[model samples]
Target: MLWRGRRQSDNVEDERSDTGGSGGFGGGSPGQFRIPIGGRTGGGSSIFIVILVVLAGWYFGFDPSQILGGGDSGGQITDDSGSEGGGAGAPASDEMKQFVSTVLAETEDTWKGIFQANGLTYEDPKLVLFSSQIRSACGFASAAAGPFYCPGDHKVYLDMTFFQQLDQQFGASGEFARAYVIAHEVGHHVQNLTGILPKFNNMRQGMSEADANHMSMQVELQADCFAGVWAHYTAQKGILEQGDIESALNAAKQIGDDTLQKKMQGYVVPESFNHGTSQQRQTWLARGYKSGKLSDCDTFNNPI
Candidate 1:
């Protein structure tokens, strides 16, 4: 990805200098994450995580709004998130800052076009850059939870160190892979604007755990698809280099619930999967990349 010299978004809130103090995130142990399950408790892990692992079930797609303000840890499903450096991420260098800002700007441009074409307005969501931990309207979160979009505050939060983790820990590298991560969270902002997220959030309260997980899968997969749509238009700008799409696809595959579960434990519990499987994620992303059409990303309507 030839991202240098690109326009950087002014909407970014660089709070790295503030360094929000440490506190227990979601009341879970630091450097690890817990998946909240309703009316279910086992040996303190997901059936998919008994061997001990989880991505917050949302590395790139974790929406803190769902977990925020939900009381009690009796159903906490804990796992090692490879986040053991303990919330103290070094500040994002100027170069990294520029890259992220550029990616955000690109996403802003792409979504604006799509929304305008459909006779709607597009709102550019703010992206917050933080170190270690930060307080959000969705609640307090650590970088270990990975980058997430908070509909409560209409902001995307990040710890730039996650890009290094994505490459070294998850075996997903390349600039476009990082871009896809940013785009996916921004996609959540799009869903929030178009009422998809609001609908899911309202309905999930009444849904069974399994049914809610299924719905969450649709929401997350659509975000992945939206990321691909961003990539589709990005390619037209003549900045994409060879192997860019493959890197993004690999990033999607790496964070899929099934793939991460297998990589951590050895098997998968399809019922506990909130994000789509590796194949499903890749398929949706590829579909959107191929068509560049929001119509192709109806995970709720199509068999995914």
Candidate 2:
């Protein structure tokens, strides 16, 4: 969490001010749609209105995958698809952007070292910061979808506002908690590179919903362990301060499938758990943090 005064990556593409461009909300919709733009009204309300329009478009029938150069849309969708949010002369709405970049850079350094020891190459993944919604290689994603990693592009998409909700709504504050969230997504990228993802996808093809969920729980727990591994390295690098691990552990517990489900839906469904329980998440994360070994994170063979 001691991230300031460090190198900020040039890999970040600042589409935060580019509005009037292709790949706006309707670009991915079927039937060559158009976004209803308001005239030169310089007010905060305009941005909110635009966000609402985008949401409405999505709610009706907009599918980001269709027009985002995926299955159709006449090959308009390219690797550089979609735009980041905000307007001209506008700053990032929160400190999360800088924090995100720092965390990403830390992950890059940590993983690069780990991979070198294992005789493999580590490719850094792009982290996309958006406001309400985003168009990613995995298709259109709303902020409500939370942060996710898309193997299609090997990038992580996050709505920074989610951090606020995570603190106020989910009761997870502390910067390391936020870092843990980022690390979890990066963990998915690690799985993708290690061929674990393909195997899971293949197995899930014929699996029942319950069985698939069980496998998903294993995947998520492994990711948590990976996050702990990142923490271990950062701690060794003297990048972590006191109570950082505790904050992250609190976050791991806060966002567990069991805790979230019990809070949101007023019930718990064990068979529907994709992420493991709060205790399982905290324990596995602790295991990785303690051991700092990839071998220690074999969630598939070990009990949660």
Candidate 3:
């Protein structure tokens, strides 16, 4: 993909180099088995998280407020062990950061146009680039959790190290592959805007874990399709190169929930798939890419 000279988003907040001492949640154990790593602030911060989740739920039409307040607030950031050095990474990480910001800006442009065409206002979302750990409306998350979109904060959280992992470990080495991951998360933000997220949350209540997982798969597949739609527009704009689609497909294949499960546990559990199969992901993405239409990505209506 040719992304140089493109507009970069100002909504990004970089917190990679900042470091602090280790602190644990001060609140008494919430009966959780795992030890708390991020520091817990007063109950007010927890309440703030709750409020954010409630707002997001109202915006998305789902009651996701329950997912908030599950942890402490204003937690201390862990040491920046995996963060890029200022002097060393200043040259390389800056470039990566710029690239990500540019991609995010482009996503905003594409989504804005789509929303306008559909007679809706587009709300721009923020993307945070962090290293090691960060606090979000979804509570504290480590880099190990990968890139996630927290509806509560309307922000996408990413660790650039994941791109390296995508290349070296997952065998998805292309820059477009990395862009695909960001687009997928941004696609979730799109669902939030379109009221699909709240509906899914409502349907998930009291459902069996398997049934919920199936619904989750549909949601993920739809996001992949949205990414394809973005790809379609980019291709039309001549921003996408010949092998960019292949890289994206390779990424979709590499991160399929079934494939990841099989690789990690030496087995696959279809019932627990939250992100669809490799073939399903690749097919849905390709469908959107080929059709260049949002109507083509109705995974909830079509059988997998």
Best by lDDT: 1
Task: For candidate 3, write residues 19-40 as lDDT tens digits.
Answer: 4123563322111111111111
Give candidate 2 misplaced runs (Cα > 4 Å).
14-94
> For each candidate, what is the lDDT?
0.69, 0.64, 0.66
> Residue 217 of model 1: what lDDT?
75
Question: Deviation in angstroms for 269 in model 1?
Answer: 1.4
Error of 2 at 266 (Å): 0.9
Q: Using TM-score as the measure, which candidate wins?
A: 1
TM of each candidate vs. truth: 0.78, 0.75, 0.77
The RMSD (Cα, Å) of candidate 3 is 12.4
Ordered by TM-score, highest first, the candidates read 1, 3, 2
Candidate with the larger lDDT of 1 and 3: 1
Tell me how many clashing residue pairs each candidate has: 1, 1, 1
In terms of lDDT, the poorest run of 10 residues in model 2 is 38-47
lDDT of 2: 0.64
